[model samples]
Structure formats: C-alpha cells, structure tokens
Target: MKLVGLSRQIVLSMMAIALGVTLLVILTSYAFYFLWRIYWPEQACEDSWIPTGPEWVWMIGATICGLALAVVVAVNLSRRILVPLNSVADSIRRMAQGDLDARAVAGDRSLGEASQLADDFNALANQLQRVTEEQAFWNAAIAHELRTPVTILRGRLQGLAEGVFMPDESQFRSLLAQVEGLGRLIEDLRVVSLAESGHLHLQVREANLAAEANAVVDMVGDALQARGQRAILELDTQPVRCDPVRMRQALLALLDNVRRYAVPGQVRIQSHAKNGWCELSVEDDGPGVPEDFIPHAFTAFRRAEGARSGGSGLGLAVVAAIARAHGGHAECRKAAGGGTVFTLIWPDLPETGLPGSNRSGRA
Candidate 1:
C-alpha cells in the first residue's frame, strides 16, 4: 500500500482510473442482470439477480486482470519517480560527507521543479567551494606577511640582548620603525575586517571634499619630498556629507600607494562635482598597473607583480569599502598622463550647509 516516491498527482490519476474501471464492471453486471430479468422473466430469480456460474467466473476473471494491470502500472510509476529522487539524495549525502565536487544531475526532460532544484543546489555548492578556496588563500597570505616582520623584530631584539649590536640611536629608531610597521599592518587588517562585516563606525558630517584631499596631501608631504615627488592639487571645493576621519584614512591609503609604487613622479590629487556626485581622484605618473591586474585592484590581499614592497595589499580595498559605506564606490582607470588614476565617488549631499560644517550622523 506504501507508494514510495509517487507524486500526489500520479497517485490520484491512477486511483481515478481504478475507480472508473470498478464502476464500469459493476454497472455492466447490473445492466445485464436487468436485461435478463426483462427478457426472460422465468429465468430471473426473485431473491437475487446474480449471474450463473460461468458468467460469474468470467466477471471475476476480468476484475482480477484489471486489478493486476493497475498493480503493474503502479510499480512502474513508482520506479520512474523514485529512481531520480534516490540519485539526488545520494548526491546530497556525498556532499555532506566532504565531497564538495558532488553534484546532482537533472537529466534532460526532467520535471521542471526537479531540474530547478538541481540547478540551485549546484550553484550553492559552487559558492561554497569558492569561499573555501578564498579562505585558504587568505590564511596563507596573512601568515607570510606576518612572518617577515616578526622575524626581523625577533632577530633585532636578540642581537641587542646578546651585545652583538650596539643600542645606538639609529639602531633603536630602526627597531621602532619596524614595530610601527607591524602595528600598521595589524590596524589595516582590523579595519578591513570591520568594513567587511559592516561594523565600521563612522561619524558622518558635512566636510569639504577638497579640504580633506589637501589635508592628506600635506600629511604625506615629507615622504613625497624624500622621494623627490611633487603632488599637484586641483581642489574643486565641493562640499560633501561623509565621515571625515574615515575619508581621510581612505585618501591617505591612496597617497600611500603612490609613495610606495610611483615615487619620484608627479602625483595629482583632485576633487570635483560631477553628475550628482563628489569625486576624489589621485593620479600618479609612474609605471601603470597591468591591464589584467586592474580588475582585481581593490580585492583584499591581492597584490600586483610590480608593486609588492612594504604593503599589506589592503589599502585600495579599504578605499572601496569606505566608498561603498558612503553609498558610492571606487574605480581604477588609466590616467590621461599614462599612469593610474584611483577615483572615489560619493553621492552629493544637499548644499544647505557651509563647506566644512559638522552635522552629527551615524553610519
């Protein structure tokens, strides 16, 4: 009686057919009984209109054959439905048992819902695989990045303790610099994590976009001078509502990129209003990012071949995150002067307030 894997529609249709067959047999038998009684009243019994022995035998045989046909059809139907379901179940089990590659195959001409379910399952599996790979890659990259500075710090401390190196001012300063670099790397990782989780606290206010750009340029002035690089500022004086501290941090990240990779060249910092947006751009006339690497320029922990010195590969990513937090985005494009231009665009706030005015808001 248990019809495993049988769909309700199929079961109902089969039941209706069986009911119709039964009704037909009952009606035919009753009609014949009435005809016999009407045509031959002498042969008709008053007590019952049951058929004679051979006629009864033939009716019973027909009923048995019809029921047997129904049973055969039910078995075949159950097999057809259960086979695919069993296959899908097996695949799910395999995937649950750490077989990320296992997939359910919905063959051509499969039922609509079954095919859709299979496709969705495959898509989820694909995403899981991708996340797993990314997690592994990030783990290795972080380990490698941390190891170098840690080894240097350990070696310098050991040398000082063992009296193998003098604790001169220059040596102490070098040690302090290494510790600062480690601290910065740790801070960058923290910020990236917060940004990724959407938990980065922002004190948004109305600030002059041009002013923030200029401030960042001034802060990196000493580094630019040391590298023989000159920064050209093109301030448009556009006011925007944003988190000033976070925005400056993002701009500093961009400037840091120029210092690390495009030193000894002209760096341009500009702010302008365009198409209902306030844009901040930093362009440098140095070796440009490779065409293939431009697409992944803002991905966390992704580094380009030419610019791998003294960086944690999270600067541009932080820029993109901060832009997105401001209901905007970041883009990397080839500059007109044969270098790279990094642009951050934010939706323009209403011009009801003066530039650099502070209005309390949360993000």
Candidate 2:
C-alpha cells in the first residue's frame, strides 16, 4: 500500500480501495454462478462449480481495471505529499553546504505539519544569515579599531629606531599611551567574549550600592571637570550581593560612554530600589540618542553620529554583558530633561545589615 514512503493517508486510501474491489469481484462472481445454476440445472449437476474461461476473463479484467485505478490514485497522492518534502530536503542540503540564502518554497496547497516545517526552516535560515552578517561586521570593525593604534605604535617605534624622532620623555610617553590603548582594546574584547560565553569570573559579596556609585563618580570626576561638566549623585543606600570589581567596571564603562558622547551638561547618577529590583541609572542633559539607533546602542562597535572620538565602541556592550552576568539587564532611553539615560537593574538582595549599610551620603 505504501509507495515511495507516501503519507499514511494515501496508504490507507489505497488499502481501502483494493479491499472494496476484491469484495465486489467475489460477490459478483458468486451471484452470476447462482443465476446460471438456477436457469440451467443440467450444468449445475455436472459437479464442477469452478469458473469457466469466459467468466474467469471477466473477473480478471475487472481486477486489472480496479488495480489500475488504485495505482493511479496512489501515484497522484504520493506526488502531492512528496514534492514539498523533496524541495525542503534539497534546500536544507544547500544550506548545509554554506548557501545561507537558500530557502524552501512551500506550495500553495501545503498545509498542516508540512507547512509548519517549511515555515520553521525558513525562519532558521534567516537567523543564520543574520548571524553570519553580524560576524562579518564584527571582524571588519575589530580590524579597523586595532589598526589605528597599532599603526601609530609601529610608526613611532620605527621613527625612534631610525633616529628620525628623539627618545625624549614626551615622545616615549605618547608611544606608551598608544600601547596602553591597544592593550585596553584587547582586554575589552576578552571581557566581552567571556561574558557572552558565560565564563566571566565573578566574586559576589554584599556591597553598598551608594558607595560604589560614589566611587565611580570620583574616578571620573576629573574628566567631567575638564569637560566643564557636573555630575550629581542621588544614590539610595542598599546592600546588594554582586562582584564589586565587576560592578565598578560596569559603572566606569557607563561613565566613559557619557564622557565620550554626551555634551557638557549636568550628568546625574541615581540608584534606588524599585519593585523587586535595584536600579542604577546614569542620565545626562545633552543631546539624546536617536530613536532609530536606541535598539542597537549596546551592540559592540556601534557608534552614533556624535561619537567622533577614538573609541572602540565596546564600552556600553561590556556594561550590558556585566549586567547580564549578574542576572540583570541594561537599557537606554531618552532622559526626560534631555540627553540619554542608561539604566542597569539587578534583583534586589534580601534585607541584611552589612558593613557598608547606613552609609547614605552622596558625593
């Protein structure tokens, strides 16, 4: 009943048709024999009820016709079911061979599980294509970012070696700075990789959120002052369990982003408990991010038009990674007054009196 691994529906249909034809043949033959015996008793008394040659011919012909009909129906049904599956298999094969653009085309009549399978395959193909494109972009961006600092270091070293440039303190300091920048870029890439791969090392302990925020502000205070910018802190004293060093690193990244992108205005840092989460936010009163670019703001190597400085664009991405490692998340939004606000939220730790508790003063 099965032809070319056809669907169960087709197999069952063929079986039913064959069975019906067999019953019809048997009943019709017996009925004809009974009529012959009733009309001609002498033939019946001859003691042979076996089918004569002409009667056998009629039954064979009917059976052949019925089988032909069954064969036609089975073939047609198999075609209807197998054609789409074949197309899907071929498309998958092409995709496995690196043709990300290959896609399965389901026929208009395809329904039920076959249609769903086609839809799922197409969706997976689209996702793979997108990831491939993003990987290409990452490679290009990283190369460009590394090339600048490396080129500078190489040129400076060559000049010094050839006596074209003097080995003065200032010259050496500049070279050292370029080397440091390159090292930082490499380290940032490592951090992002670790975070994405769920291998980032975290030393979790109870720490005061306010103290951490103030420390971060103090760390970046000089830069803000040089830019003629003022930072305000409104931290709520709360003890949260997190890796203090990693948390500070995340805060520093956010501060660096503000320093690089935001205009000279009042920068606000706030931390407070909201709902079941503790939220830490950095807000500025300068030009805000564009609406269209907000979604990709945290992506590595992504920069807005206002980002003209020499940045590798991994600052916010690292922040996001750290937040996720802490069972939290980061978000960017337009600040109410102006400019943009970046928020990091983590689940609130249970109330406990730790060493850093009761320290609520702002910096």
Candidate 3:
C-alpha cells in the first residue's frame, strides 16, 4: 500500500512497453503476409488457409515464453530499483523521528539512480548528525563554563548577605571582576556563534592594518608591560576593509594570550602586505603550542595540554572567528626564534589614508 505510486509508475511503463512490442509484432506479421501474397498469388488464393498443428504449437509456445520473460524482467527491475529507495525512505522516517544516526542502505547490486539516491540521503544524514552532535557539545560546554562563575557569584553574594564576609571595597572589586569575566565569556561565545552561523555583520571601512594593530597595542601597552612583556612593532601601512572594533578585540585576545602563556620576552606585532593580502601577526618566544594541537588551536574550547593549556580556550577561536567574519583566516605556526606566531590574513582593500600611520617603533 505504501508503494502505490511506484507501482502505478512501473505498471504504466510496462503497459507502454507491451504496446510497443504488440505494434512491432503486428507490423512484421503484416509485412510477411503481404510478401507471401505477392510471391505466391496461387497459394494465397487457396480456400483452406488455416495453420497446421505444429505451427499452432510453436506460436503458443513463443507467446508463453515471451510473457514469462517479460514478467521475470519486470520483477527483477522493480526489485533492483525499489529496495534502495525503500531503504532511503525508512532512514528518512527514522531521522524524522529524531534518530540522527539513521542512514540509507544501498546494496552493491542496486541500480544507478537508487544508489545515487541512497548516497545523497546518507550524505545529508551525516551532516545532520554532525550538526546535532556539535550543538550538544556546545550546550554542555556552555553550561560547564557558566557554572563556575555563577556558582562563585552565588557563594559570594550569599556570604555577603549572611554577614559572613565584610562588604569591603576590595571584596566588591573582586565580585565586579568575576562579573566582568562572565560578561566577556558570554560576549566571546556570542561572537563565535554568530560568526560560525554566517550572521556576524561587520562595519567594514577602509583602514590600515598597521594602524589597527598599533592602536590595539597602545590600548594594552600598560597591561603588557605589567606582565613583563616588551612590545616590538614591525608594521607597514597595509590598507584593508574591516570593523576596527572587532579587529581590536581580536588583537586584545592575542595579547591576552601572550600575557597568560608567553615567556617574559619580546612580543613582536607586525602588519604588512604579502602576495596581495594584508597580514597582521603576533609572535612570542614563549613555549610554543604542541605540534599536534596546532591544528585545533582555533577550535572553540580546545586547549593544548601542558603549560600552554590554561583559562577558557576561546581567545584564538574568537580571533579566527573575527578573521572569518572579515573574509579572512587566522593561522598559527612556529616562530623562527622558537615560539608560536599567530597571524590574521585578508585580501587588501583599496588604499586609503586612514589615521594612525606610525612607523616601526617600540612600546
């Protein structure tokens, strides 16, 4: 009953095929009869023109054989086509029922169309499964990340309310810091999510990459200095179209990463044009990321093992997200002097004289 449509189509096809065969047979028989009449006019005029017993037997046997062959062929062809399609339909049903792992089964002997349908269904199922799994992971991770800050805030507020801790300026400052951290985490997650979903809008304007880099460094100069990190600039004027606010956010994330992990040494920030693309990079001579973990460096919440693994691992991911939002990419590699170099590269925009063109200098 479920295959009524397919059955009707197959039946119509068989009927058309049978009609064609019947027409061909009728035409051939008429041709033969006409030729016989032309060649043997005397025989054609005979009164007794009936078939012999042997001829009747042969005609009946041939008709039966042809019908049997057609039935067998139709059954086999229908089976070959229907099986994979049924498998795909079943998989789709299961998927609609919330079984993301459901997949179509296409046997080796399946017809081309059936096999292709199965392949396409399986591909779609695979993508759905991946997206489902990722959503689940993100939900769990977000909960985990938020739990600590929420718990701390609750504990601290409870203590203050119960008079267990004094409401001193320092205590309030500590609470404020935690709140700020929580806010930053939320914002970071929002940015990453929007970028991944292709909804991160940028206020792109013609500006110099070197200028953005310089401004970010200047804004964080005090903090970097306090962390015993010396800033060195190797910047060149390279025009690009980007959101300065987002670009600065990305730069701050990079610098914050350096403050947390990089060794107390020179932090080289550079911007230049290379092969029609502008690159802004930050290099640190600290313990570099592990060779195996470099590939997943830009993945959200993924941190390398050892000393390099600390804090929420979303800074680099946010950098990558921002770069992608600007039609660019972020990359990490080993620096020449033995550390990690993080770079943001995007196609250069039309040259324009935006502000903040500072020559190479130290901070």
Candidate 4:
C-alpha cells in the first residue's frame, strides 16, 4: 500500500457524498418555499407574488446551477489538496523503496506549505546520497586496514605449518602481535566512531579533575613504574563540572599519547579554575610538537613521521571531538619542563552538579 498509487475510489466516494448533500439541501430548501406558497393566500397585488409555471422552472434551474457549482467547488478542492499530497506521498514511498534518485516535486499554488515540505524532502535525499558515498569510502578503508594484518598472519601460519619455515617462537609471536594489532585497531575505530558520532551515551556527572586524572594515573601506574616514571597531580581547584566517563576517556587518550612520546618521570596533571570554566592540563617531558604538526594532530588517521605512536591514530581526534561535544576544547602548549601540555577545559557548567560532587574530588 505504501508503494502503490493513491486510491481514486476513496477520493471520488468522498466527492459523491458531498454532491449528494448539496442536492439534498437544494431540493429540501426549495421544496419548503414551494410548500409555503401553497399554504399561504395569494397577495392582493398579483404582481407582488406570482406562482407562474415559468417562475417555478426558473427557480428549479437556478437550484440546479447552484448545486452544480457546489459540486465543482468540492471536486476542485479535493483534487488541489489531496492530489498533490498523494504525489508527495508517492515520492516518499519510492524513496523508501530504495530509489535514491526519487524526488518530491511540488507544483506552485498548492497551499505553498507543501512546497516547503518538498524542499525539505529533496534536501534529505541529497544528504542521503552524500552519506552513502562516505560510507562506501569508510568501508573500503577498513577492509584495506584489516586485509594487511590478515594476509601477514595467514602467510606466516602457512609457512610454519607446512615446514617451509622453522618453528621459531619469535616468528610466531610477531605474527600474533600483528593479529592483535589489527584487533585493537578495529576496537579503537569503533570507539572513536561512536564517540565522535555522538552515539556513545554520556553519563554526565560532577567529578574531581585531579582525582579523575589520578585514576587514569593509577591505571597506568604500573607501566609508568616499570619505566621509572611517576604521575604528579596538581589542581588548584578541586572539582570540575562535567561528565566523568567522557572526561576520563579524553584524559586516558591524552595519557596514552604522553606515555608513547614523553620521557620517564615527566608526567604532570595540573589544573586551574577561573570564572565559570575549569581547566585541567596534562603535561609531560616528551618532545614538543613541531609548529606545523600541531594543527594536524587532532585529525583522524594523522600522525607525525617517526612518532612511533601505538594504537589507532584516533586518540587526539577523539579528545578533540569529546571536548567539543561537551562545548569546550582541548588546547596544546609547551609544558613548564618542555614537554607537551594538553589542557581539557570545561566551558559550560550544568546547573546541578550531577552524579558526583565536584567539591569532594579535589586533591
């Protein structure tokens, strides 16, 4: 029914009912006038009221003309409103049936409201086309990324099993590592996609900027310890207003970047608050970014040459996206000790501090 054309029988039936009512009204009203004349006495002046045969015929003709006019009016109105609506309806149906090229074309003088609607419909169709193209590109890129690792693992396993190569533990471990890298890349891609697309539901709550940084600090504590590194938390303002989960994700991404780039014993988490906004900075002793590379760092799949960065190149991109989604930004600067300092600021504060108290989380 959605794909089919509009039902003409339904439309005509409605018009038939309307015409029938008009006929009934004309006949009943004139009939009453005729009966009234029959019951009343003739006028003293015959000129004043005459019940001639021709007058009756003229009155009957006029009634028929009025009824005909009423029917014409009803039919035109029904066609003007319903027919255009049906055309737009048909266009929608075709579009829903996967006809990407379908468009709802509206004729002018159609209440003008439907013209606006058709404009919206055409705009949506154009957007769908663009999205379809982008999705195709994204799929191709992912397939290429996946195939590289798979091909390597497959070749290595085949060689080992067929005795074409010696059963070396290091060789097998390398292959396994490649496979694991692919897996991590896929997962990180998924996470960044969801986070950037605003599909990751945020559990917004008040949390301590220092404490949140410290927790991520704790998670990486062992790895940093193994490298003779330590995390320092210095927050002048205790609590910051924002969602804990999302903010933590941003911080973790930054921390991961710092670990990959900075020297050991170079981690610092410092924060400051002024006006309504609070900012927390994560600085490290890593080499500062080249001036030209600073702007490109936040783009997905972008990395500096010789950076030796592990994980998907989505860390900084995700951090940027998450910050903007929360109505703020992530800023980069040179640390006091000459490492990179990334400050995540909260420009907007919720009226009620949610989930956790921002005041208590201060170190």
Number of clashes recorded per candidate:
0, 0, 0, 0
The order by descending TM-score is 2, 3, 1, 4
lDDT of 2 by residue, 151-253 (tens): 9999999999999999999999999899888887887898788877777656666789889888888889999888877999998886777667777888888
Pitting candidate 2 against candidate 3, the one with the higher TM-score is 2
Q: Tens digits of per-residue lDDT for model 3 on 190-239? A: 88987887777666677786877888888889988988899999988756
Across 135-216, the per-residue lDDT of candidate 1 in tens digits comes to: 8987898898899889998999999999988999988998899898888788778777776777666666678878877788
TM-score of each: 0.79, 0.82, 0.81, 0.56
Name model 1 segments beyond 4 Å from true.
1-85, 108-110, 349-363
Top lDDT hit: 2
Residue 33 local lDDT, model 4: 62
Clashing pairs in 3: none
Candidate 1 vs candidate 4: the TM-score winner is 1
User: Tens-digit lDDT track for model 4 on 1-363?
Assistant: 432122444455567767776776677768756765776446322563656664577578767876776677667766766655776788889978988788877654534565667677878889997788767866776676677788888998899899987888899789879977886676567766765666544455556767777788888888777766678878664565677666777888888888777777768878777898778778887678766777787777767777874556777877876676566778877666667888777664772433222333311
Question: Which wins on TM-score, candidate 3 or candidate 4?
Answer: 3
State, as a TM-score between 0 and 1, how close model 1 is to the true structure.
Answer: 0.79
Q: What TM-score should be assigned to candidate 2?
A: 0.82
- Better structure of 1 and 3 per TM-score: 3
Better of 2 and 3 by lDDT: 2
lDDT for 302 in candidate 1 is: 85
Error of 4 at 12 (Å): 23
User: Candidate 3, after superposition: displacement of residue 340 in Å?
Assistant: 0.2
